[model samples]
Target: MRANRMPPAAMQCRPHTGEALSMAASDARSGRLGFNRLQRRPARDRYDGLARFFHWTFAACIVYASVAGYTLTRLANGPVHHFLSQLNMSIGTVLIVLFPFRAGWKLVRAEPRAMHGVSARQQLLAHGVHGVLYLTMFAVLASGFLMVPNGYTFLGLFEIHTPFQKGPLTDALFAVHRASCALLAGLVVLHVLAVVKHQWIARNDVLRRML
Candidate 1:
C-alpha cells in the first residue's frame, strides 16, 4: 500500500477509538483518568442474622420432625412410638411459633444484595415468591397443630388442647396440613431452581450470598 493511503496498524480497532475517547472525556471532566479507580465494595449481605438463624434451625427441626414422623408410622402400639409421636407434635408446635417470628422479621428487614446483573423485575419476583413461601410455612405449621388428634405437650410442662372439638374443622385442618406440605415442597424447588439458573446458566453470584 502507498504510504499516504496505508491502513492503520492491525492493533488499532473501533473499540480502542471509543475507549480513548471515553478516557479523554473522563480526564477532561475530572482532571484524571478514573479507569483504574475502581473500588471493591464488600459483598453486602448473605441474609439478616434472624433469617440465617431461622434457615438453619428450621432445617434441623424439619429433619427431626420427619424422622420422628417416619418412626411413628412403623409402630402399631408401644411406649417408644407414642413418646416419639408426642415429641414430634411438641416440636411441630414450636415450629408453628418460630415460623411466624422468622417470617415477620423478614418483612421488616432488608434482604441481601442480589447477584450481579439480576434485573429489578427478577428481584421483585424473588421478594414476592419469598412472601408466598413465608405464608405457606406459617400455614403448614398452623394446620399441623390443628391436625394433631391429641394436641401438644412438652415434657409435661403444659398442654395446649386442639381448638377444634371435632367435625368439619378438624377434617379441614388436616386437609390443609397435607396440602400446605405440598406447597412448601414446590416453593423449595423453585427457590433452588432459581439459584441453579443463576449459578450454572447466568453465571452470577446468587448462591454466593448464602455461601
Candidate 2:
C-alpha cells in the first residue's frame, strides 16, 4: 500500500467526486419516485357540515330581517305592515332559539386553518368583526324582546308577554334595537365583501370552505 498512494490534492478531490456521485444518485431516485410525491400540497381545511348549515341559515335570516325591519319603518299602520311585522318578529324569535346552540358550537369546535398567504392583520380584523357581530346579534334579540309594546304570538304557537310597559324604557330599547340592527347590516355587507375579495381578487376561495 505504501508503494501506491494518492497525493494530498488527489485524495481531497476523490472524496468530493464520491459525494457528487452520491448526490446525483439521490436526485435520480427522487425523480423515479415522482416529483409530485416530493412536492405535494397540503390539504386545505374547511368548516364542518353543521357549521356551514348554521352559517348559511344565519345569513339568510339576517338578510331577510334587515329588509323587513326597514320596510316596517317605512310603511304606515296597515294590514300589510302588520303582517310583515309579525313575520319579522317570528324570524327574530327563531334566531333567539338558535343563537345559543350556534354560539356554543363555535366555542367548542376547532376553527379551520387560514388559507395560504393570509396576512396577520386580516385575521385580526376577522376576529374583531365576528366578535362585534355576536354582540350586535345579542343586542338585536334582547332589545327586540324588550321593546315589544304588548303580548304577541310567537310563530303562531304561543304568546310572548312583555313585562315592560311602552314608556321611556321601551323607547330607549327600541333605539338600541334600531342601532344594533343597522350596525349588523353594515357588518354583514363588509363580511360579504371580504369573502369576495378573498375568493376572486386574492385567489383564496375562502367561500369554498364554508360551502
Candidate 3:
C-alpha cells in the first residue's frame, strides 16, 4: 500500500511554513526574533558632536553680533555705543577665524544623509541656503574690517591701524556691511522657521540631529 500524501496545495503550504520557521530562527540568531520587520522603526541620522557644537556656536555669535549692531545704531554716540561697536567687530572677527575650521571639518567629514522623505530638490535648496549664509557672513565681516575709518580696537585689547585709507571707499564698504547684516538676519530667521516646521509640523525631529 502506498503511503498517504498531501495534496499539491497542502505540499506548497508546508514549504511556506518551513520558510516562516527558518526566518524566525534566523531572526532569533540576529536578536530580532519576534518583531515584525515592517513595524521596526527606521534608524535616525545624526550630526557628529563636533558639528553640532560648531552649528550652535556659530548661531550664538551671529545672534549676538546682530543684536549689538542694532543696538549701536539706536544709541547716541558715546563710550557705551563705541564699546558695543567694538564688541560687534570682535565677534565678526572671531567668526572669520572660525569659519575656515568649520569648512575644513565639513570637507573632511561626511555629512549625515537628509531626513527621510525629504526630496532631492529640498535638499538642494537647504544646501543653497547654507552656502548663501556662509558667503554673506564672510562678506559682512570682510566689509566691516575694511570699513573701520579710524582703526580697529579688538575688545579694547589692542589697536590695529587701518590698512585701507579712510575715504569714500570705506564709507561705501560700511554701507555694504550693513546691508549684508540685514540679509543675514533675514536668512537666520528663515532657517529657524524651517527647523521649527520640520520639528513640529512635519514631525521629522530634524532639530534633534543637531542637538
Candidate 4:
C-alpha cells in the first residue's frame, strides 16, 4: 500500500516571501540569551559580556558624578562635603580613563538586534539617539574629570600625575559639565519615552531585546 499523503490540490506550500526576520525577533532572542551576540556568556539572566560591563561601569560613574554635582552645587563648604567631593572627583577621573576602551568596544562590536516591528525611520532615529547618547556620555565623563579642583591623580597601582594646576579653568569646566548634564538628562527622558512607547504602548517586546 502507498504511504498516505496530502493530494496535490490539498498540499500546502510556502512562497519565497523575501521578508527576513525583523530586528525585533533578534532582539527578543538577545534578551533571552542574555547577550545579543551568537556566543553566550557565563551568567544567565545577566547581560552579555559587553552589556554587563558597560552597564555597571557607567552606572557607578554616573552615580558618583551626579551626586558630586548636586553636592558641589549646594554644599556650604565644609570637611564632609570636601571629602565627598574628592571621592566623587576621583570616580569621575577613573571614568575618564576607562571611557575610551568602553566606547571603542561599542564602536567595534556588532550592536544588539533592533526590534523588528518598527519602521525604517524609527530604527534610524533610535540609531541617532544612541550615537548622541554615547558621545554625550563620554563628554560628560571627561568634563567631570576636568572640573576637579587642584589636580587629579589616578587611583590605579601608581599615583598618577596631575592633569591641571588651578581651579578656575576646572571650575569653568564644571559649569559646562553642569549644563551638559542637564541636556543629557533631558535626552535620557526622551529616550525613555521612546522606549516605553515602543514597549508599553505598542505592546511589543522591543525593550526586552536590550534588557
Candidate 5:
C-alpha cells in the first residue's frame, strides 16, 4: 500500500511552526541585548584610595585623642596622667602638622556627588557639618597646643615647643579646647548616626562609597 500523505492544511502549518521558532529566537536575542545595555551602564563613583586612607586615619586619631584627653583631665596628678597627657598632646601635634596636607589634598581632589535621591537640603546640611568639623578640628588642635604652659616631648622622640606661657591666657585656651572637643565629639556622633540611617533605614548604602 502507498504511504498516506498529510493534509494540505497540516502541510501549510509546518511553515508557521518554523516561523514561530524564528520569532522566538529573535525575541531571545533582543532580551540578551537589553541585558548587555544595562551591564554597560556606568558604575557609581567612590572615594579614591588616598581619600579613604585620610578618612580612616582622621577617624582613629580623633577617637584616641578625645578619649585620652578626657581621661587625663579626670585623673589625679600622677605618672599615669602624665603619660596619657603626653601621648594625647603628641597625637594632637601630629594632627596639626598634617592638617595642611590633608586640606590641600581635599582642595585638589574632587568629591563625588551626593547619592541619587538625596535632597538638596540634605546635601547642604552635609556640607555644613563637614566644614564645621574641619574648623572644630583646627580649633581643638590649636587650643590644645597653646594651653600647654611648658614644652612637651613628643613620642619621646623630640621636643615640641608651645608659643604661650603659663598664665590666664592658657586657662582661656584650655576652656576653648574643651568646648571644641565636645563639639567635635557631637559632630562625630551625628556623622556616624547619619551613615547608619542611610545604610540601614533608608537602604541607601552610602557607606559603601567610602569603603
Candidate 6:
C-alpha cells in the first residue's frame, strides 16, 4: 500500500500544472500594474464627506436657477417676474462666490478613480463634458452681470454697481447669456443620462461615489 501511494509532495505539485501557473502569472502581472489594486482599494467606494456635501449643494443651486430662469420667461412684465429674476440672479451670484472655494478643495483633495471596467476613452469624454459645463456656467454668470448695468440689489441688503454702461453691447451680452443657458440645460440632461446608464445598464453604481 505504501509503494502504491503517491508522494505528498507530488500530489501537491500536481494541482499547479502549466495552465494554473500561467493564470497565476497573469494575475501577478495585473496586480503589479495596479489594476487589481485599484478595485480592492477602500477609497474607491465613495468620495470624502466634504466633497459629497459640495456636490449636492451645487446640484441644488443649479436646479433652482434653471427653474427660476424658465419661469421668468413665461411670466409677463410684473412684480412677480421681477422678483423671480432677482432670485435667479442671487442664486447665480452665490454660485460665483462658491465656485472658487469648491474648485480649490478639489485641487487639494484626491478624486475617486473611474469605475474598474470603464474604458479610458469614456473617462476622457466624461472629463471633457465636465470642463464644458464649467465654462458654460462661467459664461452665463459673467454675461448676466454685464446684461444688468444698474447693478444688483441683494434682497435689499446691498447693491453691486454695473461694471459698464448698458447699450448694444449689453443686449449682445444678454443674448450670449440666454444661449449659454440653453446649452447648459442640454449638457445637464446628458450628464443625467450618463449617470442612469452607469447605474442601470452598466450596473456600476457610479453615483454612489458622490453620494
- The candidate, 1 or 3, that scores higher on lDDT is 3
Candidate 2 per-residue lDDT, tens place, 1-211, comes to 5598678999899989999999999999989778777566454489988889889999999999998888888999999998898888888888889999999999988688888789899899889899999999999999998898886787678888877878999999999999999899999999989888889999987878998
Write the number of the candidate with greater TM-score, choosing between 4 and 5.
5
What's the lDDT for candidate 2?
A: 0.88
lDDT of every predicted structure (CA atoms): 0.76, 0.88, 0.86, 0.69, 0.89, 0.85
Looking at model 5, the pairs that clash are none
- Identify the runs in model 4 with alpha carbons over 4 angstroms from their true place: 1-47, 152-160
TM-score of each: 0.67, 0.77, 0.76, 0.66, 0.77, 0.76
**Alpha carbon lDDT of residue 147, candidate 4?**
63
The most accurate candidate by lDDT is 5
Model 6, 1-211: lDDT tens digits are 4578898998888777866999999989978879866766765478889888878888898888888888888999999998888778787788778888777787798778679779999999998998898889788878887898778887667887887787898999999999998998999999999999999999998988887
User: Using lDDT as the measure, what is the rank order of every candidate, best first?
Assistant: 5, 2, 3, 6, 1, 4
Off by over 4 Å in 3: 1-44
Q: Roughly what TM-score does model 2 have, to 2 decimal places?
A: 0.77
- Model 1 C-alpha lDDT per residue in residues 107-152, reported as the tens digit of each score: 7876676677888998899889988987887887888887776566
Supply candidate 5's per-residue lDDT for 127. 89
Q: At residue 155, what lDDT does model 4 achieve? A: 41
RMSD of 1: 13.8
